[model samples]
Target: MTIDPEASPPRPPGRPRSREADEAILGAALDLLIERGMGATSIEQIARRAGVTRATVYRRFPNLTDLLVRAIEWEYQNTQPEALSWPDVPAMIRDWAGQLSVPRSRRLIRRLYGTVDDLPELLRAYDTAHGSHRGRAVRSTLEQARTTGQLPPHTDPETLQLILSGAALQHLAAYPDTTEPKDIEAYFLAVLRQVGFPAASPSPSRRSTQR
Candidate 1:
């Protein structure tokens, strides 16, 4: 039998990629980012921690920024609030408090922000991946609040979002020790009230539990 000269060559059989190695690399990248920040963490460290070859990591994530950003996104998917839309400010605040209560989570957040100037690509990638949808959801929640009189009729959802976001970051800096969910919730509620948020009352369960 004569092989056609124009026919494509047969592909060589190669080893299939390991899910475990992929997970290990991602987890190592996230942990390094949280512990050492971008400046201090290196691909070599990640590879050593992940027990994978540097070539393997490069094959999976050709870009360092992409690797770190993907690792952060993975962490958020696993640890952050799950709801795409919140019904009220209190619910959103509670979820935020719950996630921020974890010291590791707070450290990760700080590291991400710290890398803004050094590794802006990471932030840009993250915004591209998750910020747009979450931002729209937040604005919609604020609009619902305005409609329900939780906010003033003239309240600008966009501005309020910026203020609340700044408040949370400031709170993190000012009261790093305040890791308890109830305490964080109280602090956020106070900030909201000060900003004329007038959020709807939390559920009876939360009220009783807080007390």
Candidate 2:
């Protein structure tokens, strides 16, 4: 398991906060982080964009690093697998392809990955927070499939998860002609075909469940 930096330095307990303000601040922070990155994003900028007082932003987060960490997490959550339970392998592949095919998602992925070397803390913050949610879920689903004899005896869940996600991320980051959802969907299906995507057993647990 990876260290969870986001869980450390826990949030302080206080009076109930205004939900709208929280959303506004987070929204503004995410926009700034994506548009300019950690170096350029600041509390003042977020405050101005969110139309909230600096004090309000401070009340929520003590520092810019914390704020950026949370904003990165917000972006990460938006892209994670939506299925809380098991999802169909083919369908999830297509869904991920569709997501990565979009211009917004492409830019977000490029920005995040482009910053990985320069800003290790950005990744540390995100990885510690929610980077592995999709991997975990996919692993669980693969394990279930293997255990049920739906997948080949040689099927490796971890590697499969890496290959699936890695391909999607690479395609999103590297490909320019994949802006169409169908293009992405087609690409993922090709990957699946190469891997011989196992047919799901006629079982309830194998059915896709979208969140």
Candidate 3:
């Protein structure tokens, strides 16, 4: 499995954590978070759902908060594209559209957003695991685009990044049930153009490949 650079370091020296048990625990936590939300999720429930002893969970994570944080991080690590750098803007857009189109993914994201005040750690974990990294990758791609004239000379990648990210969040709120990949792709591409990214539309063949 690919390691997450932002993932917490290995546990202190002692007994090794079972990979199977870890997966089970994380998976259970995620399910409970989506099904029950943060307020109702507990370590005992996670342990029960994971089919592991409370002691087994305590041995791995100290509390419910830590376990849930790790669960969100694990989910992102599994779902996101592994490449830290994208070759181009359209590739990034394609990958993000596919990710956003999953119903479970949309639900999970909404659940995470609902945790902002009551359970800030989940969002923090997400930012650490993917948000910051994705921002850098997108900025780098925008820089390349500007140099290559795909974007206007005066286009500020940093400002544009913020705008693009905000637009995505706005879109998620505006159309919470949108699950069609092509529709999601079109929305993002339009947002990109509105923000001054002038990359041409994907050809029919490229669109088919993305599907």
Relative to the true structure, how large is the alpha-carbon lDDT of every model?
Answer: 0.80, 0.72, 0.83
| Candidate 3, superposed: residue stretches over 4 Å from native | 1-13, 77-82, 176-178, 199-211
Candidate 3 minimal-lDDT segment of 10 residues: 2-11
Clashing pairs in 3: none
Ranking by TM-score: 1, 3, 2
Q: Which stretches in model 2 have alpha-carbon errors above 4 Å?
A: 1-15, 74-82, 144-151, 198-211
Model 3 error, position 37 (Å): 1.5
Candidate 3 on 108-177: residue-level lDDT in tens? 8788889999988898898898888888889999899888878888889999888888877776778866
Name the weakest run of 10 consecutive residues (lDDT summed) in model 2: 202-211
Residue 154: error of model 3 in Å? 1.4
Clashing pairs in 2: none
User: Per-residue lDDT for 85-197 in model 1, tens only?
Assistant: 78898898887888778888678767777888888877766666566667887888888999998987778999988987888788777777457999999988887787677
Candidate 1 segments whose C-alpha is farther than 4 A from its true place: 1-15, 77-82, 199-211
